[model samples]
Target: MTKYSSEFKVKLVNEYFDGQISILGLSKKYGMPSKSPIYRWVHEAEANGLNYLITKKSHKEYSQDFKLSVIEYHKLHEISRLDTAIYFKISPSQVNSWIYRYNHYGVIGLRRRPRGRRPLMAKKKKKQTRLNPTKEEKYKQEILDLKAKLHDAEMDRDILKALKTLRENDPNSKKQN
Candidate 1:
Protein backbone atom coordinates (compact mmCIF):
# COMPACT_ATOMS: atom_id res chain seq x y z
CA MET A 1 0.00 0.00 0.00
CA THR A 2 1.09 3.57 -0.58
CA LYS A 3 2.40 5.48 2.40
CA TYR A 4 0.18 8.47 1.72
CA SER A 5 -3.38 8.46 0.39
CA SER A 6 -4.38 10.34 -2.76
CA GLU A 7 -6.74 12.68 -0.83
CA PHE A 8 -3.96 13.51 1.62
CA LYS A 9 -1.58 14.20 -1.26
CA VAL A 10 -4.08 16.49 -2.89
CA LYS A 11 -4.62 18.30 0.40
CA LEU A 12 -0.90 18.84 0.82
CA VAL A 13 -0.51 20.08 -2.75
CA ASN A 14 -3.43 22.42 -2.20
CA GLU A 15 -1.84 23.65 1.03
CA TYR A 16 1.38 24.31 -0.84
CA PHE A 17 -0.56 26.19 -3.51
CA ASP A 18 -2.14 28.38 -0.83
CA GLY A 19 1.40 29.84 -0.31
CA GLN A 20 1.10 29.65 3.46
CA ILE A 21 3.84 27.00 3.96
CA SER A 22 6.86 25.97 1.96
CA ILE A 23 7.54 22.36 0.95
CA LEU A 24 9.84 21.94 3.95
CA GLY A 25 7.26 23.48 6.31
CA LEU A 26 4.50 21.18 5.00
CA SER A 27 6.82 18.19 5.35
CA LYS A 28 7.67 19.21 8.93
CA LYS A 29 4.01 19.87 9.77
CA TYR A 30 2.95 16.45 8.47
CA GLY A 31 6.06 14.71 9.87
CA MET A 32 7.22 13.57 6.42
CA PRO A 33 10.66 12.11 5.98
CA SER A 34 11.48 14.69 3.31
CA LYS A 35 9.97 17.19 0.89
CA SER A 36 10.96 15.08 -2.12
CA PRO A 37 7.56 13.43 -2.37
CA ILE A 38 5.79 16.78 -2.18
CA TYR A 39 8.00 18.07 -4.94
CA ARG A 40 7.16 15.02 -7.07
CA TRP A 41 3.47 15.28 -6.35
CA VAL A 42 3.38 18.95 -7.19
CA HIS A 43 5.29 18.33 -10.39
CA GLU A 44 3.07 15.44 -11.28
CA ALA A 45 -0.07 17.51 -10.73
CA GLU A 46 1.29 20.42 -12.72
CA ALA A 47 2.61 18.31 -15.60
CA ASN A 48 -0.35 16.04 -16.04
CA GLY A 49 -3.51 16.84 -14.07
CA LEU A 50 -5.09 16.40 -10.67
CA ASN A 51 -6.21 12.93 -11.82
CA TYR A 52 -2.52 11.98 -12.00
CA LEU A 53 -2.43 12.33 -8.23
CA ILE A 54 -5.29 9.88 -7.60
CA THR A 55 -4.37 7.31 -10.21
CA LYS A 56 -1.70 4.71 -9.55
CA LYS A 57 0.68 3.72 -12.31
CA SER A 58 0.90 0.07 -13.31
CA HIS A 59 4.06 -1.69 -14.45
CA LYS A 60 5.13 -0.23 -17.80
CA GLU A 61 7.74 -1.08 -20.39
CA TYR A 62 9.45 1.88 -22.10
CA SER A 63 11.02 1.42 -25.51
CA GLN A 64 14.74 1.91 -25.95
CA ASP A 65 14.20 5.07 -27.99
CA PHE A 66 11.91 6.54 -25.33
CA LYS A 67 14.44 5.79 -22.59
CA LEU A 68 17.22 7.31 -24.64
CA SER A 69 15.16 10.44 -25.26
CA VAL A 70 14.42 10.85 -21.57
CA ILE A 71 18.06 10.43 -20.70
CA GLU A 72 19.15 12.81 -23.40
CA TYR A 73 16.61 15.42 -22.34
CA HIS A 74 17.72 15.08 -18.74
CA LYS A 75 21.36 15.44 -19.70
CA LEU A 76 20.69 18.39 -21.96
CA HIS A 77 18.51 20.24 -19.43
CA GLU A 78 20.65 19.38 -16.36
CA ILE A 79 17.48 18.72 -14.38
CA SER A 80 16.88 16.39 -11.46
CA ARG A 81 15.63 12.85 -12.03
CA LEU A 82 12.36 13.77 -10.31
CA ASP A 83 11.84 16.62 -12.74
CA THR A 84 12.65 14.40 -15.69
CA ALA A 85 10.33 11.72 -14.40
CA ILE A 86 7.45 14.14 -13.81
CA TYR A 87 8.02 15.60 -17.23
CA PHE A 88 7.82 12.16 -18.78
CA LYS A 89 4.99 10.95 -16.52
CA ILE A 90 7.12 8.17 -15.06
CA SER A 91 8.49 7.40 -11.63
CA PRO A 92 11.71 9.13 -10.55
CA SER A 93 13.21 5.73 -9.69
CA GLN A 94 12.70 4.68 -13.30
CA VAL A 95 14.70 7.67 -14.47
CA ASN A 96 17.42 6.95 -11.93
CA SER A 97 17.60 3.30 -12.99
CA TRP A 98 17.81 4.21 -16.67
CA ILE A 99 20.56 6.73 -15.98
CA TYR A 100 22.48 4.18 -13.97
CA ARG A 101 22.16 1.51 -16.63
CA TYR A 102 23.08 3.92 -19.41
CA ASN A 103 26.15 5.07 -17.52
CA HIS A 104 27.30 1.54 -16.78
CA TYR A 105 26.52 -0.07 -20.17
CA GLY A 106 25.59 2.69 -22.66
CA VAL A 107 22.39 2.96 -24.74
CA ILE A 108 22.03 -0.79 -25.32
CA GLY A 109 21.72 -1.15 -21.55
CA LEU A 110 18.23 0.37 -21.76
CA ARG A 111 16.99 -2.60 -23.78
CA ARG A 112 14.71 -5.05 -21.98
CA ARG A 113 16.26 -8.39 -21.07
CA PRO A 114 14.66 -11.77 -20.49
CA ARG A 115 13.73 -12.33 -16.88
CA GLY A 116 14.33 -15.26 -14.49
CA ARG A 117 17.08 -17.89 -14.28
CA ARG A 118 18.55 -19.05 -17.59
CA PRO A 119 17.88 -22.62 -18.72
CA LEU A 120 20.51 -25.13 -17.65
CA MET A 121 22.86 -26.53 -20.31
CA ALA A 122 22.57 -30.19 -21.20
CA LYS A 123 25.75 -32.26 -20.85
CA LYS A 124 26.84 -34.41 -23.77
CA LYS A 125 27.60 -38.03 -22.95
CA LYS A 126 30.81 -39.54 -24.28
CA LYS A 127 30.67 -42.66 -26.48
CA GLN A 128 31.67 -45.84 -24.62
CA THR A 129 33.07 -47.63 -27.69
CA ARG A 130 35.62 -46.62 -30.29
CA LEU A 131 34.61 -45.79 -33.89
CA ASN A 132 36.18 -49.01 -35.11
CA PRO A 133 37.51 -52.06 -33.24
CA THR A 134 39.50 -55.06 -34.57
CA LYS A 135 37.64 -58.37 -34.38
CA GLU A 136 40.28 -59.73 -31.96
CA GLU A 137 39.96 -56.69 -29.69
CA LYS A 138 36.12 -56.95 -29.73
CA TYR A 139 36.31 -60.65 -28.87
CA LYS A 140 38.72 -59.98 -26.00
CA GLN A 141 36.42 -57.24 -24.54
CA GLU A 142 33.39 -59.55 -24.81
CA ILE A 143 35.28 -62.36 -23.06
CA LEU A 144 36.33 -60.00 -20.22
CA ASP A 145 32.71 -58.79 -19.80
CA LEU A 146 31.40 -62.35 -19.71
CA LYS A 147 34.03 -63.33 -17.12
CA ALA A 148 33.03 -60.35 -14.90
CA LYS A 149 29.32 -61.31 -15.14
CA LEU A 150 30.17 -64.95 -14.29
CA HIS A 151 32.22 -63.83 -11.27
CA ASP A 152 29.28 -61.73 -10.00
CA ALA A 153 26.84 -64.63 -10.47
CA GLU A 154 29.21 -67.02 -8.65
CA MET A 155 29.58 -64.56 -5.74
CA ASP A 156 25.78 -64.27 -5.44
CA ARG A 157 25.40 -68.09 -5.53
CA ASP A 158 28.02 -68.49 -2.76
CA ILE A 159 26.25 -65.93 -0.52
CA LEU A 160 22.91 -67.77 -0.96
CA LYS A 161 24.63 -71.09 -0.21
CA ALA A 162 26.17 -69.67 3.03
CA LEU A 163 22.81 -68.16 4.10
CA LYS A 164 21.06 -71.50 3.49
CA THR A 165 23.64 -73.41 5.55
CA LEU A 166 23.33 -70.92 8.46
CA ARG A 167 19.50 -71.06 8.37
CA GLU A 168 19.53 -74.91 8.33
CA ASN A 169 21.91 -75.06 11.37
CA ASP A 170 19.83 -72.53 13.40
CA PRO A 171 17.00 -74.30 15.24
CA ASN A 172 15.28 -70.90 15.80
CA SER A 173 14.98 -70.30 12.00
CA LYS A 174 11.38 -70.31 10.71
CA LYS A 175 10.57 -72.55 7.78
CA GLN A 176 8.58 -71.16 4.79
CA ASN A 177 7.19 -72.89 1.70
Candidate 2:
Protein backbone atom coordinates (compact mmCIF):
# COMPACT_ATOMS: atom_id res chain seq x y z
CA MET A 1 0.00 0.00 0.00
CA THR A 2 1.19 3.46 -0.84
CA LYS A 3 1.30 5.49 2.32
CA TYR A 4 0.75 9.13 1.36
CA SER A 5 2.64 11.61 3.44
CA SER A 6 0.69 14.02 5.58
CA GLU A 7 2.10 16.86 3.46
CA PHE A 8 0.67 15.26 0.31
CA LYS A 9 -2.69 14.91 2.02
CA VAL A 10 -2.60 18.56 3.07
CA LYS A 11 -1.62 19.70 -0.40
CA LEU A 12 -4.51 17.82 -1.92
CA VAL A 13 -6.89 19.25 0.61
CA ASN A 14 -5.59 22.72 -0.01
CA GLU A 15 -6.09 22.26 -3.72
CA TYR A 16 -9.69 21.34 -3.06
CA PHE A 17 -10.10 24.28 -0.71
CA ASP A 18 -8.74 26.72 -3.25
CA GLY A 19 -11.43 25.58 -5.75
CA GLN A 20 -8.76 24.21 -8.08
CA ILE A 21 -10.48 20.81 -8.03
CA SER A 22 -13.34 19.00 -6.30
CA ILE A 23 -12.46 16.58 -3.48
CA LEU A 24 -13.30 13.64 -5.70
CA GLY A 25 -11.19 15.03 -8.52
CA LEU A 26 -8.32 15.66 -6.15
CA SER A 27 -8.53 12.07 -4.93
CA LYS A 28 -8.40 10.77 -8.50
CA LYS A 29 -5.51 13.05 -9.32
CA TYR A 30 -3.54 11.75 -6.36
CA GLY A 31 -4.55 8.12 -6.93
CA MET A 32 -6.16 8.01 -3.47
CA PRO A 33 -8.42 5.03 -2.89
CA SER A 34 -10.91 7.09 -0.95
CA LYS A 35 -11.81 10.75 -0.48
CA SER A 36 -12.79 10.44 3.18
CA PRO A 37 -9.23 10.71 4.55
CA ILE A 38 -8.53 13.66 2.32
CA TYR A 39 -11.71 15.32 3.51
CA ARG A 40 -10.65 14.61 7.10
CA TRP A 41 -7.23 16.12 6.47
CA VAL A 42 -8.86 19.20 5.03
CA HIS A 43 -11.07 19.60 8.06
CA GLU A 44 -8.18 19.07 10.44
CA ALA A 45 -6.03 21.50 8.52
CA GLU A 46 -8.73 24.15 8.65
CA ALA A 47 -9.14 23.75 12.40
CA ASN A 48 -5.53 23.10 13.48
CA GLY A 49 -3.70 25.28 10.90
CA LEU A 50 -1.27 24.43 8.14
CA ASN A 51 1.41 23.13 10.53
CA TYR A 52 -0.51 19.86 10.59
CA LEU A 53 0.69 19.40 7.01
CA ILE A 54 4.22 18.45 8.05
CA THR A 55 4.80 14.74 7.50
CA LYS A 56 7.18 12.65 9.54
CA LYS A 57 9.19 9.80 8.07
CA SER A 58 7.74 6.31 8.39
CA HIS A 59 9.61 5.02 11.43
CA LYS A 60 8.89 3.24 14.69
CA GLU A 61 10.03 6.20 16.74
CA TYR A 62 6.90 7.31 18.57
CA SER A 63 8.07 9.07 21.71
CA GLN A 64 7.31 7.61 25.12
CA ASP A 65 5.14 10.67 25.74
CA PHE A 66 2.95 9.87 22.72
CA LYS A 67 2.60 6.23 23.69
CA LEU A 68 1.73 7.22 27.25
CA SER A 69 -0.82 9.69 25.98
CA VAL A 70 -2.51 7.03 23.84
CA ILE A 71 -2.53 4.61 26.75
CA GLU A 72 -3.97 7.25 29.00
CA TYR A 73 -6.75 8.02 26.49
CA HIS A 74 -7.57 4.34 26.25
CA LYS A 75 -7.65 3.94 29.98
CA LEU A 76 -9.42 7.10 30.98
CA HIS A 77 -12.04 7.18 28.23
CA GLU A 78 -14.70 4.49 27.89
CA ILE A 79 -14.69 4.81 24.13
CA SER A 80 -16.53 2.28 22.00
CA ARG A 81 -14.64 0.30 19.39
CA LEU A 82 -16.31 2.14 16.53
CA ASP A 83 -15.56 5.51 18.04
CA THR A 84 -11.95 4.60 18.68
CA ALA A 85 -11.58 3.22 15.18
CA ILE A 86 -13.01 6.41 13.62
CA TYR A 87 -10.71 8.55 15.74
CA PHE A 88 -7.67 6.46 14.87
CA LYS A 89 -8.60 6.02 11.17
CA ILE A 90 -8.66 2.25 11.54
CA SER A 91 -11.22 -0.54 11.27
CA PRO A 92 -13.61 -1.12 14.17
CA SER A 93 -12.62 -4.77 14.35
CA GLN A 94 -8.98 -3.75 14.71
CA VAL A 95 -9.89 -1.46 17.58
CA ASN A 96 -11.92 -4.27 19.19
CA SER A 97 -8.98 -6.68 18.93
CA TRP A 98 -6.62 -4.08 20.34
CA ILE A 99 -8.90 -3.42 23.29
CA TYR A 100 -9.29 -7.15 23.96
CA ARG A 101 -5.55 -7.73 23.85
CA TYR A 102 -4.73 -4.63 25.90
CA ASN A 103 -7.18 -5.63 28.60
CA HIS A 104 -5.65 -9.10 28.83
CA TYR A 105 -1.94 -8.35 28.23
CA GLY A 106 -1.46 -4.58 28.83
CA VAL A 107 0.88 -2.49 26.64
CA ILE A 108 2.46 -5.44 24.86
CA GLY A 109 -0.96 -6.28 23.44
CA LEU A 110 -0.98 -3.12 21.34
CA ARG A 111 1.95 -4.42 19.32
CA ARG A 112 -0.06 -6.74 17.12
CA ARG A 113 1.45 -9.31 14.81
CA PRO A 114 -0.32 -11.46 12.26
CA ARG A 115 -2.20 -14.21 14.07
CA GLY A 116 -0.64 -17.66 13.94
CA ARG A 117 -2.69 -20.81 14.52
CA ARG A 118 -6.41 -20.57 15.16
CA PRO A 119 -7.52 -20.63 18.79
CA LEU A 120 -7.85 -24.15 20.20
CA MET A 121 -11.60 -23.92 20.50
CA ALA A 122 -11.88 -22.76 16.91
CA LYS A 123 -9.42 -25.35 15.60
CA LYS A 124 -10.84 -28.39 17.32
CA LYS A 125 -14.05 -30.06 16.25
CA LYS A 126 -16.85 -29.69 18.78
CA LYS A 127 -17.23 -32.83 20.89
CA GLN A 128 -20.33 -34.87 20.05
CA THR A 129 -21.68 -36.82 23.06
CA ARG A 130 -25.12 -38.18 23.90
CA LEU A 131 -24.46 -37.84 27.64
CA ASN A 132 -25.63 -34.23 27.46
CA PRO A 133 -28.90 -34.61 25.59
CA THR A 134 -30.64 -31.44 24.43
CA LYS A 135 -33.97 -30.55 26.03
CA GLU A 136 -36.13 -31.44 23.02
CA GLU A 137 -34.54 -34.85 22.51
CA LYS A 138 -34.82 -35.70 26.19
CA TYR A 139 -38.47 -34.71 26.25
CA LYS A 140 -39.20 -36.75 23.14
CA GLN A 141 -37.53 -39.84 24.59
CA GLU A 142 -39.43 -39.43 27.86
CA ILE A 143 -42.74 -39.22 26.02
CA LEU A 144 -41.95 -42.34 23.95
CA ASP A 145 -40.99 -44.35 27.05
CA LEU A 146 -44.06 -43.19 28.93
CA LYS A 147 -46.31 -44.12 26.03
CA ALA A 148 -44.75 -47.64 25.82
CA LYS A 149 -45.10 -48.23 29.58
CA LEU A 150 -48.69 -47.00 29.54
CA HIS A 151 -49.56 -49.41 26.71
CA ASP A 152 -47.99 -52.33 28.57
CA ALA A 153 -49.74 -51.45 31.83
CA GLU A 154 -53.09 -51.13 30.07
CA MET A 155 -52.63 -54.56 28.47
CA ASP A 156 -51.66 -56.10 31.82
CA ARG A 157 -54.76 -54.63 33.55
CA ASP A 158 -57.02 -55.89 30.79
CA ILE A 159 -55.57 -59.43 31.08
CA LEU A 160 -55.99 -59.44 34.90
CA LYS A 161 -59.61 -58.24 34.68
CA ALA A 162 -60.45 -60.94 32.12
CA LEU A 163 -58.93 -63.63 34.41
CA LYS A 164 -60.94 -62.37 37.36
CA THR A 165 -64.19 -62.42 35.34
CA LEU A 166 -63.47 -65.88 33.99
CA ARG A 167 -62.69 -67.24 37.49
CA GLU A 168 -65.90 -65.81 38.94
CA ASN A 169 -68.04 -67.33 36.19
CA ASP A 170 -66.22 -70.69 36.15
CA PRO A 171 -67.03 -73.53 38.54
CA ASN A 172 -63.51 -73.46 39.98
CA SER A 173 -64.28 -70.94 42.73
CA LYS A 174 -61.30 -72.05 44.89
CA LYS A 175 -58.72 -70.56 42.44
CA GLN A 176 -57.46 -66.97 43.11
CA ASN A 177 -58.36 -64.27 40.55
Candidate 3:
Protein backbone atom coordinates (compact mmCIF):
# COMPACT_ATOMS: atom_id res chain seq x y z
CA MET A 1 0.00 0.00 0.00
CA THR A 2 1.07 3.60 -0.54
CA LYS A 3 2.31 5.63 2.42
CA TYR A 4 0.34 8.65 3.64
CA SER A 5 1.89 12.11 3.91
CA SER A 6 3.52 12.87 7.28
CA GLU A 7 1.30 15.93 7.80
CA PHE A 8 -1.83 13.88 7.15
CA LYS A 9 -0.61 11.09 9.43
CA VAL A 10 0.23 13.67 12.09
CA LYS A 11 -3.14 15.33 11.76
CA LEU A 12 -4.83 11.98 12.26
CA VAL A 13 -2.54 11.32 15.20
CA ASN A 14 -3.46 14.68 16.69
CA GLU A 15 -7.12 13.92 16.25
CA TYR A 16 -6.58 10.56 18.00
CA PHE A 17 -4.58 12.26 20.74
CA ASP A 18 -7.48 14.65 21.42
CA GLY A 19 -9.68 11.55 22.11
CA GLN A 20 -12.16 12.74 19.50
CA ILE A 21 -11.83 9.50 17.44
CA SER A 22 -10.96 5.83 17.94
CA ILE A 23 -8.11 3.96 16.22
CA LEU A 24 -10.50 1.99 14.00
CA GLY A 25 -12.45 5.13 13.22
CA LEU A 26 -9.28 7.03 12.27
CA SER A 27 -8.19 4.17 10.04
CA LYS A 28 -11.56 4.24 8.27
CA LYS A 29 -11.55 8.03 8.09
CA TYR A 30 -8.19 8.16 6.37
CA GLY A 31 -8.97 5.10 4.19
CA MET A 32 -5.89 3.40 5.57
CA PRO A 33 -5.81 -0.35 4.99
CA SER A 34 -3.93 -1.12 8.27
CA LYS A 35 -4.55 0.16 11.77
CA SER A 36 -0.90 -0.46 12.85
CA PRO A 37 0.43 2.70 11.16
CA ILE A 38 -2.08 4.86 12.98
CA TYR A 39 -1.14 3.28 16.29
CA ARG A 40 2.55 3.88 15.48
CA TRP A 41 1.81 7.51 14.62
CA VAL A 42 0.03 8.06 17.96
CA HIS A 43 2.79 6.37 19.99
CA GLU A 44 5.47 8.33 18.14
CA ALA A 45 3.53 11.55 18.70
CA GLU A 46 3.30 10.87 22.44
CA ALA A 47 7.01 9.94 22.80
CA ASN A 48 8.41 12.64 20.48
CA GLY A 49 5.68 15.32 20.73
CA LEU A 50 3.52 16.94 18.02
CA ASN A 51 6.53 18.49 16.23
CA TYR A 52 7.64 15.05 15.07
CA LEU A 53 4.20 14.40 13.64
CA ILE A 54 3.94 17.72 11.76
CA THR A 55 6.70 17.07 9.24
CA LYS A 56 5.21 18.66 6.11
CA LYS A 57 2.57 21.11 4.96
CA SER A 58 -0.44 20.21 2.78
CA HIS A 59 -2.26 22.39 0.25
CA LYS A 60 -5.68 23.85 0.98
CA GLU A 61 -7.82 24.55 -2.03
CA TYR A 62 -11.32 25.53 -3.06
CA SER A 63 -12.22 23.51 -6.18
CA GLN A 64 -14.26 26.31 -7.76
CA ASP A 65 -11.50 28.87 -7.35
CA PHE A 66 -8.92 26.48 -8.76
CA LYS A 67 -11.03 25.93 -11.88
CA LEU A 68 -11.54 29.67 -12.31
CA SER A 69 -7.83 30.35 -11.98
CA VAL A 70 -7.04 27.73 -14.58
CA ILE A 71 -9.49 29.32 -16.99
CA GLU A 72 -8.26 32.86 -16.33
CA TYR A 73 -4.63 31.86 -16.70
CA HIS A 74 -5.31 30.36 -20.12
CA LYS A 75 -7.53 33.23 -21.34
CA LEU A 76 -5.85 36.38 -19.96
CA HIS A 77 -2.33 35.27 -20.91
CA GLU A 78 -3.36 33.96 -24.37
CA ILE A 79 -0.94 31.09 -23.77
CA SER A 80 -0.69 28.28 -26.32
CA ARG A 81 -1.78 24.79 -25.28
CA LEU A 82 1.85 23.55 -25.26
CA ASP A 83 3.08 26.60 -23.28
CA THR A 84 0.31 26.16 -20.74
CA ALA A 85 1.23 22.49 -20.39
CA ILE A 86 4.88 23.42 -19.74
CA TYR A 87 3.75 25.93 -17.08
CA PHE A 88 1.40 23.39 -15.41
CA LYS A 89 3.48 20.24 -16.12
CA ILE A 90 0.53 18.59 -17.88
CA SER A 91 0.10 17.35 -21.44
CA PRO A 92 -0.45 19.79 -24.30
CA SER A 93 -3.59 17.88 -25.30
CA GLN A 94 -5.02 18.34 -21.79
CA VAL A 95 -4.37 22.09 -21.99
CA ASN A 96 -5.88 22.15 -25.47
CA SER A 97 -9.08 20.47 -24.24
CA TRP A 98 -9.27 22.83 -21.27
CA ILE A 99 -8.90 25.84 -23.55
CA TYR A 100 -11.57 24.42 -25.84
CA ARG A 101 -13.91 24.03 -22.88
CA TYR A 102 -13.18 27.53 -21.51
CA ASN A 103 -13.81 29.03 -24.93
CA HIS A 104 -17.17 27.27 -25.26
CA TYR A 105 -18.57 27.50 -21.68
CA GLY A 106 -16.24 29.64 -19.52
CA VAL A 107 -15.00 28.10 -16.22
CA ILE A 108 -17.15 24.98 -16.71
CA GLY A 109 -14.89 24.00 -19.64
CA LEU A 110 -11.87 23.52 -17.37
CA ARG A 111 -13.56 20.62 -15.60
CA ARG A 112 -12.04 17.24 -16.54
CA ARG A 113 -14.12 14.97 -18.77
CA PRO A 114 -13.70 11.29 -19.66
CA ARG A 115 -10.72 10.83 -21.99
CA GLY A 116 -11.37 9.76 -25.59
CA ARG A 117 -9.48 7.17 -27.69
CA ARG A 118 -5.95 6.17 -26.66
CA PRO A 119 -2.82 6.77 -28.82
CA LEU A 120 -2.17 4.66 -31.96
CA MET A 121 1.02 3.12 -30.57
CA ALA A 122 -0.86 1.92 -27.45
CA LYS A 123 -2.96 -0.46 -29.56
CA LYS A 124 -2.01 -3.87 -31.07
CA LYS A 125 1.26 -4.45 -32.87
CA LYS A 126 1.23 -4.05 -36.65
CA LYS A 127 2.78 -6.48 -39.16
CA GLN A 128 5.40 -4.45 -40.97
CA THR A 129 6.76 -5.26 -44.49
CA ARG A 130 10.28 -4.62 -45.72
CA LEU A 131 10.54 -1.83 -48.31
CA ASN A 132 13.63 -3.40 -49.90
CA PRO A 133 14.65 -6.99 -50.74
CA THR A 134 16.18 -8.98 -47.87
CA LYS A 135 19.77 -10.17 -47.71
CA GLU A 136 18.84 -13.80 -48.54
CA GLU A 137 16.93 -12.77 -51.69
CA LYS A 138 19.83 -10.58 -52.87
CA TYR A 139 22.29 -13.46 -52.33
CA LYS A 140 20.06 -15.87 -54.26
CA GLN A 141 19.83 -13.48 -57.25
CA GLU A 142 23.61 -12.96 -57.22
CA ILE A 143 24.19 -16.76 -57.31
CA LEU A 144 21.80 -17.08 -60.28
CA ASP A 145 23.68 -14.35 -62.19
CA LEU A 146 27.04 -15.99 -61.36
CA LYS A 147 25.81 -19.37 -62.65
CA ALA A 148 24.77 -17.74 -65.98
CA LYS A 149 28.22 -16.09 -66.31
CA LEU A 150 29.99 -19.40 -65.54
CA HIS A 151 27.91 -21.21 -68.24
CA ASP A 152 28.86 -18.54 -70.82
CA ALA A 153 32.56 -18.85 -69.86
CA GLU A 154 32.47 -22.64 -70.24
CA MET A 155 30.82 -22.30 -73.72
CA ASP A 156 33.58 -19.82 -74.77
CA ARG A 157 36.29 -22.23 -73.52
CA ASP A 158 34.75 -25.16 -75.51
CA ILE A 159 34.53 -23.03 -78.69
CA LEU A 160 38.20 -21.93 -78.34
CA LYS A 161 39.39 -25.57 -77.85
CA ALA A 162 37.44 -26.76 -80.97
CA LEU A 163 39.00 -23.92 -83.09
CA LYS A 164 42.50 -24.82 -81.85
CA THR A 165 42.08 -28.53 -82.87
CA LEU A 166 40.71 -27.61 -86.33
CA ARG A 167 43.58 -25.11 -86.94
CA GLU A 168 46.23 -27.68 -85.86
CA ASN A 169 44.80 -30.32 -88.27
CA ASP A 170 44.68 -27.98 -91.34
CA PRO A 171 47.57 -27.74 -93.89
CA ASN A 172 47.30 -23.88 -93.67
CA SER A 173 47.88 -24.20 -89.87
CA LYS A 174 51.36 -25.82 -90.61
CA LYS A 175 52.42 -22.75 -92.70
CA GLN A 176 51.75 -20.48 -89.63
CA ASN A 177 53.28 -23.10 -87.20
Each model's C-alpha lDDT? 0.80, 0.60, 0.62
The digit string of per-residue lDDT tens for model 3 on 1-177 reads 335677787789878978989999998987879897787567656655667555444432334345445545564566655445545544345556655755565444343444678676757676885235356535544554565567678889999999999988888669753
Q: How would you encode candidate 2's per-residue C-alpha lDDT over 32-110 as one tens digit per residue?
A: 7998777756765675566755653453434323433444445445455444544554444545665575456544444
TM-scores of the candidates are 0.60, 0.37, 0.29
Q: How accurate is candidate 1 locally (lDDT)?
A: 0.80
Candidate 3 Cα deviation (angstroms), residue 172: 99
- Candidate 2, residue 162: how far the Cα is off, in Å: 78
Give the poorly placed runs of model 1, Cα more than 4 Å off.
116-177
Error of 3 at 167 (Å): 99
TM-score of 3: 0.29
Model with the higher TM-score, candidate 2 or 3: 2
Against the true structure, whose lDDT is highest? 1
TM-score of 2: 0.37
Alpha-carbon deviation at 84 in model 2, angstroms: 7.8
Candidates sorted on lDDT, descending:
1, 3, 2
Candidate 1 worst ten-residue window by lDDT: 130-139
